[model samples]
Target chain A: MKFSDFICSKAIRHELSAPDKEGVIRELTGALVAAGEIAEEDLESIVGAILKREELGSTGIGRGVAVPHTKHPSVEKLVGTVGVCADGIDFTALDGENVELFFLLVSPPDRPGDHLRALENISRQLRDDMFCKFLKQAKSAEDIQTLLDEADGDQFGP
Target chain B: MNPSEANKTVVVKNPKGLHLRPAGVLAQLAAAYDSEITLTKDGLTVDARSILDLLTLVATQGSELTVAASGSDAQQAVEALSHFIANDESDEEE
Candidate 1:
């Protein structure tokens, strides 16, 4: 349920180059593939599934965060990666704000419980304004990972 | 401050508890009333108006939730929210 439990450091990126929603998804998924978390052959399918989920409703839950997720058969277990966009992308957020932080999750179709727990864990950490501010200000992947480690350690109280 | 307050304890009936979709429905309903509404479980209280806060509760199936409202329409708000939690049918799609 902790961010560190499912998020691999290899998949974390800082200041992603993509400027739009589709581009962001592709970039983040590509990161996962490069890290060997996802098969390169399944990359396009995963991105397509996430985009289709967005059609139902943007995962951009506002406050500069977007949790774009999908249930894919290719993924045996729940996996996710974090990306920071220096220039925000238009996500059509519920609050009508651009999203700067992206947490893209891909989980097996059978694990709804795990998916919900991950979402809860991510949102719980995000509720702290200081955590969000520090994540946005992170200059490197290591910096972002360190912040997540501290947050998971209860350094930022509930 | 208005002193009229109402509270109800309801057991979550949905198989998935208050996940995103159901929590979103609860938040939307809670936002319709002017009352200050909160849902508490396991000693953690969260504003009912925020989908994010509600999701943080992580209420699984059969979990007990205490819905509380304070304001002019406190009674109505609590009743509606408790009913919604106990009989939510919107999250059937998974």
Candidate 2:
């Protein structure tokens, strides 16, 4: 799926100011709350759930990618955010590398299929080395979206 | 992938087959188990443990695929996974 399908402009953080895991999560999830996709009161719980899921297993699949996801009852539909950290962060990837591209996914607990499908969509597209390189170099939200748009066209279909 | 689980293989008998949709379904069932699940296709082995990894296999229509799970519940995994593969309805969810 393209960025247009799931990622809103607010969800795309071109220049993340957060320096650590908690900081980065707060920064990304706060945008989701501001965009009205999540409730202000639910932000802490959402982030907590995501952290807890990470404790179970690192979503960092390596190759400069991390897909942190959790299914919560508070969410009624599949929602996600994408953050590009050009400065890089220590995400403890399976391949023992840092992470620069992060996809945070929150889905309704009832919709496992939707969650998997969304993750599958992202993971499959990220498999393209050239696309990942382009995304890593993207400097603006529009640039990131454009890369995703082109990658979506090339990888999935037009 | 162990051959003990290897003996238990199922073909994509569903009319719609194990395309993106059905593969997603199989992946879901596979995830519920604690075992390491691996799907083999055309000599390539994918971590059935991961829905994303399973999708990478891209099992198409009438593709011959094998789903093997090894862990505490390997037998249950094989039973449930085989059932999931065999029960093929185009609109099935989860």
Candidate 3:
């Protein structure tokens, strides 16, 4: 559930160039597949499932954050990717603001504990205003990963 | 498959019903299933796969719900979700 346990190093896009929801999901899925976390064939289905979930309500939890996730058969274990958008995208958040931080998660189709843990981890880290501010200012993927490492260590008491 | 045949239905027995907290628990439980799951309540069905969709159902106390799971792991999904409601983990703080 910790960021270090799941966030993909290669999949971390410091500043995503996707302009819309679908495009962003594709970008994330491609990253996951390339990272060997998800099967390429399951990319569309996973994205579709997450989008369907979004229809119920925006994952956008406010303060420019969105956690779009799904439990799909393609994943053998819990996997996640983080993206920071410098320009941000309109995610129809409850707070009526654009979302710049996206945490995309995919877990095994039968791992409820992992899902909750991931949610808890994401929610806990996002609650830190300073951590989020540092994440937003990160200029590269390595920089963002470093920020997450520090944040994860602080939250988990490692 | 007919939704009813997918699995035995379980009614919401919790005193406060399937509010946000219970819904979160159910959503968490549903994520542990490989089969496709759906929760039917108030004549509407929501994808149990999505935590957000499950939350929107918001079935109150005494509201009956049908938890259906399809595909190879149907039985397992039914069991997990049924146990989730039966255990009444809604009262626990996140």
The top-ranked prediction according to DockQ is: 1
- Comparing 1 and 3 on lDDT, the stronger one: 1
Worst 10 residues of 2 chain B by lDDT: B1-10
Per-residue lDDT tens digits for candidate 1, residues B1-93, read 465999999999887668766786788899999999999999999999988899889888899999999998999999999999999855433
Models ranked on lDDT: 1, 3, 2
C-alpha RMSD over true interface residues, each candidate:
1.9, 7.1, 9.7
Clash pairs (backbone) in predicted model 1: none
- Per-residue C-alpha lDDT of model 3 across residues B6-58, encoded as one tens digit per residue: 66567776655554345655666777766788988778787775544664555
Error of 2 at A59 (Å): 0.6
Clashing pairs in 3: A110-B32
DockQ (Cα-based) for each candidate: 0.52, 0.13, 0.04
The better candidate by DockQ, 2 or 3, is 2
Docking class of 3: incorrect
lDDT of 3 at B66: 84
In model 2, the runs with Cα more than 4 Å from the true position are: A155-158, B1-52, B55-94
How close is chain B to the truth by TM-score, in each candidate? 0.93, 0.74, 0.79
Cα distance off (Å), candidate 2, residue A23: 1.7
